[model samples]
Target: MLIAYARSLVYQEQAVRKALLELQNPRRKRAFGGTLTLGEFSLAPHLKTFFQGHPDVDFSLKIDNTKEVMSLLEEGILDFCLVEGLFPKEGYDVVLLKEVPFVLLVSPGHPLAKERKVSLEELFAYPLILREEGSGSRDIVEKALAERGYDIHGFQKIIEIGNISLMKRLTEEALGISFMYEDAARKELAENTLVQVAVKNLHLTREFNFVMMKNHLEKDEILGYAKEFQGFFAKEAGRF
Candidate 1:
């Protein structure tokens, strides 16, 4: 049985290994089984690599609003999930993975594209393309606007889109201005297809975290995976 477990771990071909490793009590080895939601902008690229490194896991993905992600966690449908937001409540545990800065994205020819710094009032003049209502990005943007005494009701035009790629495409076409993470807009910014507009005295940011029930915190398997993920992100974080 030990040999079989070793083979399973080597192949990384079964979620059983991950489940077994997470067990705090030997008898509880097979108790864990559920889906996990990984919420972020364009996570598919990274998730593919993550699963490849642990082929034994049988988890699936669900792309949904951050609110939905939290709701699912509360419903016990998701074993855990990564999200960009404040910690949910007292009963949960959150490991803050990273903090991302938000920046304005616009087409190359947009008037404010060349500006070094723009005030919140100046940004209000243009048509804004925002993420869906429950998005972490949206929450940060709304909070920033509120602090500046500006609200969605005062915008010239506000459009909501559910997908990040669509928001990028729309911004590139000069259809609207968008606020997005710097990492998400790296390629477009590099190719000169889009420009990042800085907001003066307005530093928008969000913290990404891995959240799970308190009960899972003591599980060795869960702890090991969390540590591995933390190390992976730590290396990546250094580059940015």
Candidate 2:
């Protein structure tokens, strides 16, 4: 099959490229992409240290939602991506970097903020602030709701936002409650500007993965880099 042949050729290219990197004959360029959450908390913090140790490696990074980043990987626009949402794994190599819990965010003054935990029906009575359709966090929320025999439409009001910071700001202003990873709103939570609403019987977590096309030429090299990023994330989480 032509597809099989192409994959073999790509593997061969990876071998050749690794050899070239070892020789230091020329500067090697690496391309990486990630979803918004990992881009901000994971990749951004590790870059300076990574570059300091591997000066010969020239790299570029792209940040977008999980769907867009995965599309870019399939199209060869990115060598790999750090993803924070649900994706098909059929033809891709994946490294699970981390698993983070999802929580409901609300303003400190919101009525539900004082409650220890709320039932699904009760939580849906308030307005919901959510990331746009293609975002990883949004997809997770949708899936979680479905699993509980509910749908996003159950919310009294829905506010779709593309930016995480804006979503947090809106939540802080009591505009709506948001569902997202806890780390994304840590600073605000620590300051008591926002509070986490516990949903009774709900425990949801999302995975962060380093994903690449199965036959990408830099697969192994990128795997090493991915582990480095994972290490940094682990260290950060330990601090909390």
Candidate 3:
């Protein structure tokens, strides 16, 4: 089917455009500027490197829930999105950046912090603080709960938080408990401000993805760069 599409006369003009974009003479300038958007917090260090490595690129990153990032991608408002968990492959190019575990977060003062193990149902008994509606963390946790015949909304007490920094602060204050990617709370865990308590009945892991609309990579040179970026991340996936 791809071959048939490639052979179609309808794409002849687009192919010519791609060829022109790949021509050496077209790249007269050495600098470019663009925006970077992401859903996962773990990408912070790598994102810093990505920007630092390309000083002339002048890129800025926006952090939000995966759903909103994908929305911006669909609207052509983002160059690409670094996402967490499953994303549709249709009409887009996807690169799996990494896979990491998500764990329960509790303030040092919370009862569960001292407990050896807590079940999913027992977690629902506490004041649960969750990421906003479109967040990847919220999505992953809800799906996991659904598989066990539970739901985030079914929890006894709930608090919805939009910002991760604020959520961590709230948790540190013993306002509520949350589940997040383990690396996201590493500093707090190390400082003893937050603790990781195993959810005895559940263990959740999610994937990080780099996604861009296929049309956005229309130029052969652009596609080459995107693939190169994919290889770079894949090589360092385990470290992230």
Candidate 4:
């Protein structure tokens, strides 16, 4: 987190001051750059277009799971963050930038691959792959199950993995089944390497939130950029 904080502050020097001055005058070219934290890799393609239009603005982009993004934002280490899944609203204010659906991911060879949908009870019979403790996907899934009167630990052979790439690789190898955003699994799905499974009665959905300090909303300098950041996703969010 400290490394992320330092890297983000690099744009805080002359560039930022000059940018802020330019922001005051409409006729001047605007220049502002800082750091941004991202919880979902799916947002990268959209952000690429945004950066192309703002050449003068330099930003440090950090990729982390939704769990860590919330902690960093709450500690004020990040000016703003985009995350998958829901976060607590106590210390942070959030805009619903988008709503994305998740699907069950399994190897093509898995018996359930040909099935349109499977019950949650049948999924419990297999070895389940889950994200690490701080993952937003894991949190939401667990919460959903708990609400259904299911014990989280009741799933057989629950394996915890931290790296998304590695997790996908393991799932492709038919080690276990996992859940992820459909967008993230696009390539695998296209190539027929991974098959998406739908849950019979469950809808796996989450939000892509633009989150920041609630109090900062009333401040000008931060608010302007924060709202601008939120708008980027808000406009494109309709595609989801």
Instruction: State the C-alpha lDDT per candidate.
Output: 0.67, 0.83, 0.66, 0.68
Candidate 3: tens digits of C-alpha lDDT, residues 1-240:
563343233334444454465474543222111112233445554556555665544454566667766766555445566677655566666766566788889999898889998877788777889887767778778888889898877777889987777888999998889888776787788899999999887878877666665665344544554565566567666454
- The candidate with the higher TM-score, 2 or 3, is 2
Q: How accurate locally is residue 9 in candidate 4, as Cα lDDT from 0 to 100? A: 52
lDDT of 2 by residue, 1-240 (tens): 565455446545665665676577577777779898778865677778877878888778899998888776766667788998688776778888888888988899999999999988997788999999899899999998999899999999999999888999999999989998886877888999999888888888888898877776656787888788789888987987
Clashing pairs in 2: none
Error of 3 at 34 (Å): 13
* Alpha-carbon deviation at 4 in model 4, angstroms: 23
TM-score of each: 0.79, 0.88, 0.76, 0.75
Among all windows of ten consecutive residues in candidate 2, which has the lowest summed lDDT? 3-12
How well does model 2 score by local distance difference test? 0.83
- Per-residue CA lDDT of model 1 for 90-145, tens digit only, reads 55566766777778898988998889888878877889999888777787788888
Better-scoring candidate (lDDT), 1 or 2: 2
Residue 70 of model 2 has an lDDT of: 77
Q: Give one clash count per candidate, in the order shown.
A: 5, 0, 0, 0
Query: By summed lDDT, which 10 consecutive residues of candidate 3 come out lowest?
Result: 28-37
